[model samples]
Target: MTPTVISPASPVELLHYMITYQRYPTTLLICSSDDEFRAAIAEELKGQIPEEQLQQEPDEFGEVIIDHPLAALPIFRRVVARHLRVLFVPSVIHLRAILSVFSQADSPIPPPPEEDSENTKQGARPRPPSLFAYGFLELHRDSSEWSAQGLSSSASMFVAAARRSGFNPVMVEPKAAGGLANFEHVLREHAPILSGGARRDEGWQGRTVEVRRVFDRWFRFQTGQWDIKWPEDNAS
Candidate 1:
């Protein structure tokens, strides 16, 4: 529930979630160690999003990125802090870096890691933001075989780590030919956690208690014996 979903159509779904789900200005963060795939994804995004919306500023939704593995996590931390909403599609290596924050058994929103010398400006103790940006991370399966016996072919050591760690990525599968529309519907189903307005305090007393439920869910994630939630236990 770290505001990231895992699916095959991640880049497409990330854009769909950002633009179609809400009007708040957001950033599309591309995390890659090289420009090998960034350019192609950028071109594809251009076709779906208007030219004006791609401007990288607070006034408008925009596309931003980190092409360095070392700088990816620190920069992403800053981006999510600055922008109210951010939909990031990160390379696998970069994804792990972004997710490492959750593994630390310390503060929920701890300051940037010590290794990030560039984050010296982020004060000694930064207060956690009330709300967070949501997005997707693409799951890629290399042809490598599982070292553990009897595990499914899809379950590699890395995949198992993802399942147990604080990465806590929600697994989503695209329906056959369901297209972006189907994914949007599914996102609507998961909106309690994914929506930017999820943390809004106004009119909470009148709502059907979704806000309270959200708080309990987060509390469970922080205090539970296992930080990860089984996909089948909560949802199909």
Candidate 2:
């Protein structure tokens, strides 16, 4: 399944998302490459999000579905372990998404699970939502949308993880603006999460960032509330 990706208006727009929606410390920044784009993004996010919170891409960039199952990948395992929301920022990175029934993608691999027959019965693992979760999946795309993250590749696993986290993600993008120019002057400004006046998209004209929740009504992971209303906002 394709990962739900978002190409925001600017880097400031992305920072605004983190400040407004992802106020908690449950988010994780997973860089896909150490190239200029990733480096620029990491550099820009310094004062806004802690350095430790970010996880740069490892050497195993394009070697997914190579040595181990997608479930066994370190990043995937970490997402399962920490219940952390993932922001898979990447540039020129691709991974093997699906393995055909006969194609030799991974050798000595076990047979894919077959559809159970009418009488065949097997034990199935229980799927339950996390008791304590406050995170969601978000991808801040640069100019080229779906170019970084594997759009039609291995992304279903991530969606499953988010569902277990007890909430859904609302992807924000540059609806009217042309596209993001670069990753500079990110986290330049921040508004209190609780405070709101004009909508964030109303007057953001330049380097200054006035971040707030992109949507007036959305699912809040921290409180498990969907209709989160700000007094100053939606008063009219």
Candidate 3:
């Protein structure tokens, strides 16, 4: 499947597309660093789809809330198998972790056996079936705090990662509710390809792994200066 990019005109239209095209037994992971955007998407989805179709609590709307992506690694397979409709992850950090897990699904590295454990005594536990087939959607909110270049670069990284992992990822940047019509118009133009009816040209070409490594190193190096300055601050 060819990777495609979607620029939804508004959040409402984006939610509509998500609810309309979401297939059964394949969960839709909506990830973003902005809590407000995440909640907004969830609220929009709840309003659009039937309440009974969703998984909610007695007093609150029930949705699978993942605090961290790495934490979900162990049960991701089970969650996908159950055919969850929507999952809310708080950050792109978690998204990266999930992508890494799926990309490495083919050759999972099992943990070392415990010393004299019952399971180890008999044999190592069998690895779970790969859960690489699932849909991913990223909704990037234009942050006033982040530069335009930063947002573009971040989006590019996501596009690259999705392409490398063979996922037809969809990304939308909805400026406001009033823009729904324009967003829907764009979606209609790309509906055929998004629905697997047509193949779009490849526009992303980058190694997500390498980009992540560079990002991590840069982050560490930038933050490491804090440790170096801590001593000076205390002395003064």
Q: Which one is best on TM-score? A: 3
Q: Once model 3 is optimally superposed onto the true structure by TM-score, how far is the C-alpha of residue 202 displaced, in angstroms? A: 36
Better of 1 and 3 by lDDT: 3
Span of 10 residues, lowest total lDDT, candidate 1:
142-151
Best candidate, lDDT: 3
Score candidate 1 by lDDT: 0.33
**Alpha carbon lDDT of residue 5, candidate 1?**
32
Sort by lDDT, top down from the best: 3, 1, 2
How many pairs of residues in model 1 come into backbone collision?
0
Give the poorly placed runs of model 1, Cα more than 4 Å off.
Answer: 1-12, 15-37, 50-79, 82-102, 105-142, 146-167, 172-236
lDDT of 1 by residue, 1-236 (tens): 34333322433444344334422122233433325334544545556665565544433344353233223333334334433233344444444455443232332333334424634566753322222212221132111111111112222322333444433323333332223344434332212222122223442122222312322332222221122368876895
- The Cα local distance difference test for each model comes to 0.33, 0.30, 0.37
- lDDT (tens digit, per residue) of candidate 2 on 57-81: 4455642122212223242333333
Error of 1 at 77 (Å): 7.5
User: Where does candidate 2 stray beyond 4 Å?
Assistant: 1-7, 28-150, 170-236
Model 1, residue pairs in steric clash: none
**Root-mean-square deviation per candidate:** 17.0, 15.5, 20.1
lDDT, residue 84, candidate 3: 31
